[model samples]
Target: MQKEIKAIIDGWRNYFQGSSSVGLTLAQERAVICSTCEYAKYGKHAAILPDAQIGNIQGYYCGVCKCPLSTAVRSSGYECPKNKW
Candidate 1:
């Protein structure tokens, strides 16, 4: 739980500090992987990952971690629950 908060902090800090929230490369890479992931659920799961955007896709929540990918991908604190990233 605490780790999630730290990841959010790091992600936002990276965003405000630069043009990209997930940094330049790694974050984008993570997003790319997540874009095709079946676990990146949305629609009815909107509340958990609201206002989300990843690469070209809309919003989504990681079915494994159950967190917003937009924010989670940006952070170094949060790792892919499935270790894909």
Candidate 2:
């Protein structure tokens, strides 16, 4: 819960600073970790939207934290609920 708050704050800060994306390398590394995690879930329902997409893959969200990886990875203040990040 606390981590989510920090990420939200940091996201807004970055948005206003004209920096919406993180370093590509870091993002890729995080994505790779998420991709192979057991908690990674493909979002197929309207209520559960994907947080990121790779190629034609729809996207995935963390089953534990219920966060969209696409958005969470981009936040500098984000910490994985499972401490994977």
Model 2 weakest 10-residue run by lDDT: 49-58
For model 1, give the 10-residue run with minimal summed lDDT: 49-58
TM-scores, each model vs. reference: 0.68, 0.65
Per model, state how many residue pairs clash: 0, 0
Per-residue CA lDDT of model 2 for 9-71, tens digit only, reads 774454345454576457667778887889888775324533233322236777987766665
List runs of model 2 lying over 4 Å from the truth. Answer: 1-3, 9-21, 45-58
Q: Write the per-residue lDDT of candidate 1 for residues 1-85, one digit (tens) a residue.
A: 8977888788666644554544667777888898889888864434443433344334676888676677677788888888888
- lDDT for residue 79 in candidate 1, whole number 0-100: 85
| Best-fitting candidate, scored by TM-score | 1
TM-score of 1: 0.68
Q: After superposition, how far is residue 7 of candidate 2 from its true place, in Å?
A: 0.6
lDDT of 2 at 13: 55
